[model samples]
Target: MKLDARSAARILRDPGALRVILLHGDDTGLVRERARTAALAVAPDLDDPFRVAVLDRDAPERLEEEVFALSLTGGRRVVWVRDATDAMTAPLKHCLGQASDTLVIIEAPGLTARSRLRTLVEGHAEAAAIACYPEEGRALEASIRQMLAAEEIRIDPDALSWFAGLLGPDRAATRGEVEKLALYAGRGGQLSLDDVRACIGDAAGVSLEDAAFAATAGDRAAADTAIERALAEGTSPIAIARSLLSHLHRLRRARLAMDSGQSRTDAMRALRPPVFFKRTEAFGQALSLWTADRLMDAAEQTQSLELDCKQTGAPDLTLCRRHIARLAGTAMMLRRDR
Candidate 1:
């Protein structure tokens, strides 16, 4: 069965009826978060080796075996597959068709409508597919409220709107920001716009908004300086790279809208978490420099660099710096050509 975002939380709370739950989407963070939530629903003790088994896409054949195996401790069992792909479709289909008590959750990247894996899960009577996209509009506000309420924190309506506007596309990042605000406000205290700015503004490399703006706007010196400051202040290279990718994605959207005959001003105004007023001109200049196709290419390169930084043998900070420097150089060249 196909699950919409509104019904997803309710279904996740009691996923016992479903044998296989497939969480696939472009938002990797949301996919992983939902997968963990579902796993914990079945196997509360995630750390227990006997109850929870984590596998990768390579071991699709082992899925059925793991599902059929009786739990050593005699309670509910969970078998989670990470980075699932089409290659595992056959085994998953066979496994989902059989009767089993174990909860099988597959975390996959975004799948096409015609994808066999997506079709199998969505079409099967015993399975369900939950799409994990970035939340926006009313949905985004509701999520913010829910997360903040969990911490017993309250915010002024205006403050809540401002804070929500600053949130990134990644759910994990959004959670982190809310948690930071909650901690700052303390229990039962109300947050104001001032508090939001104080806690979030220039809080190290965590908020790479400034650096990202600089990089994309062809301010090579400012971008280089900001990146160096962030790294010096202990910001992870992967985090910075992700921020850059998010910014580029926004630019791509604006460019696409313009290609479709919308005015640049209108396109920028329509952006979710709307562009900050201070950086409006820089953002416009970025649109002029990076076309939709070039933005896509830059995004791919940044993602690859982030993956490399995560490798054990890699110098993450150094690799991140190199990536930013290269982008800065490209930005400069693009500007000269224009």
Candidate 2:
């Protein structure tokens, strides 16, 4: 059956008689983490080759055999199938309804609801499909708060709201940021708005946002400064590109709202995280400068640049700089036309 978040988490701690556990979603980090949790519940040492079997997509005949095969160590075993897909349906199907102490864990990151593997697992009584999407809004805030609370730390409401926006979509990345905050606060401490800014403002996420805003507002020097700092701080150029893409996507939303007769301020207000107060003026400028079509083109350009950055021998930093220059130049041209 398909498991809710609570049920899925509970199962990882105590998976009784479950033949196959499918963790699928866009949040690959969460999926991998949960998979390891569930597997560790069965086999205490997942690194032990005798008790755990890790398989890739196009693997040998070990999958079905590993599912039912008794471990040499004489304990419950774990079979981890990474990057699973609809193609894995038949292999996993054969394991269902059979009596075995082995647990089959599948990590499928991009499976849709109509996916055959998902349908099959949810249909079975002895199997489960768990979705691991990224947390957002109140959910994200609560998660950060709960995590810190466990560490005996408290974050002020405003700081929590701002901190939530700094987190990325990846669950592991979000947890890393939370851990940083926890360490910053120490035990039995509180995080205020100023503290949050001091801790995370210099982070790559914020720096990337700074670069993105500078580029979109036609501030070439500022964009270059932020971009160089981000790269020098060990952030990959692709991450910088994605940050730009995210900014453009946000602009696309606001532009659509403006197209529907909402004022730019209204469109900004409609944003979930709201424009960070510091970026409010530049945000407004970008909104005013770019038409909806121009924002679409810039978003596409950034997306392609991200893919290009992945190519071997590519000058990723140089390419990223050029892309930022283009964005700034375009914004300038739009401003002149206005």
Q: Against the hidden reference, what TM-scores do the models get?
A: 0.65, 0.68
Instruction: Highest lDDT: give the candidate number.
Output: 2
lDDT of 2 by residue, 1-338 (tens): 98998798789999998888999987887898899889988888878998999999776356889888778878888999999878888777776756777888999997988999999999998888899987777887887888899989998886887677556567787788888888899999999887888888778778788889998998888988988887787666766776788789888899899999998889999985578778899999998888889899999989899889878799988999899888988888888888
Worst 10 residues of 2 by lDDT: 161-170
Find the number of clashing residue pairs for candidate 1: 0
Candidate of highest TM-score: 2
Q: For candidate 1, report its TM-score.
A: 0.65
Please list the residue runs of candidate 1 whose C-alpha ends up more than 4 Å from where it truly belongs after superposition. Answer: 203-338
- CA lDDT of each prediction against the hidden true structure: 0.82, 0.85
lDDT tens per residue, model 1, 143-184:
888888887888887677656644645787778878888899
TM-score of 2: 0.68
